[model samples]
Target: DVKVTQSSRYLVKRTGEKVFLECVQDMDHENMFWYRQDPGLGLRLIYFSYDVKMKEKGDIPEGYSVSREKKERFSLILESASTNQTSMYLCASSSPTLLSNQPQHFGDGTRLSIL
Candidate 1:
């Protein structure tokens, strides 16, 4: 079975603060992604990494960055947190195969609140 674990289920931070969200996958997947979910916008990809130490910006990458120093771990960093960045953050992992339609396994998500 595949499993993606998020460091936090809920988080609270103040404006202008730096935040780190961590995720770990046990399936040894070749691809990992970070996404923020909002009421109307749905899931917006922030970043994704296909290999260790390699990252690519996704749909919404402003004010956020990602690090994948190790194969099993991926971290999302919010350089300067703001109220508008408050949302549910999700981590997902997928196997890199010829079939691009493979489903990504996701974490339970971290509900973040900025004040």
Candidate 2:
């Protein structure tokens, strides 16, 4: 079974603080994604990497960044956390070679609280 591990299940921070959320997948997936979930906004992709060292910014990329130095690891970074940025962040992994209709397997998610 494929498993995705998130470094923190819950986090709290003050405004203007830098936050780092880490994710690691046991499966050797070719694609990894970071998304922020909020009320009414649904799940908005923040960034994704198709391969090692390759990254693509998603819809809401203004307040977030991502890193993919290895095939099984992806990290999301918030340069300066803000109150509005407080939300549940999800990490997912899927194989690019798989069928396009296939759904991505998501991690448990990290709930970030920005005061």
TM-score list, all predictions: 0.96, 0.94
Pairs clashing within candidate 1: none
Give the TM-score comparing model 1 with the true structure, all chains together: 0.96
* Model 2: pairs clashing at backbone N, Cα or C within 3 Å: none
lDDT tens digits, residues 1-115, model 1?
9999999999999999999999999998999999999998899999999999999999999999999999999999999999999999999999976259999999999999999
Q: Give the C-alpha miss distance for residue 25 in model 1, angstroms.
A: 0.2
Tens-digit lDDT track for model 2 on 10-113? 99999999999999999899989999999998999999988999999899999888888999999999999999999999999997664476579899999999
Model 1, C-alpha of 3: deviation from truth (Å): 0.4
Regions more than 4 Å wrong, model 2:
none
- Whole-model lDDT, model 1: 0.96
Worst 10 residues of 1 by lDDT: 95-104
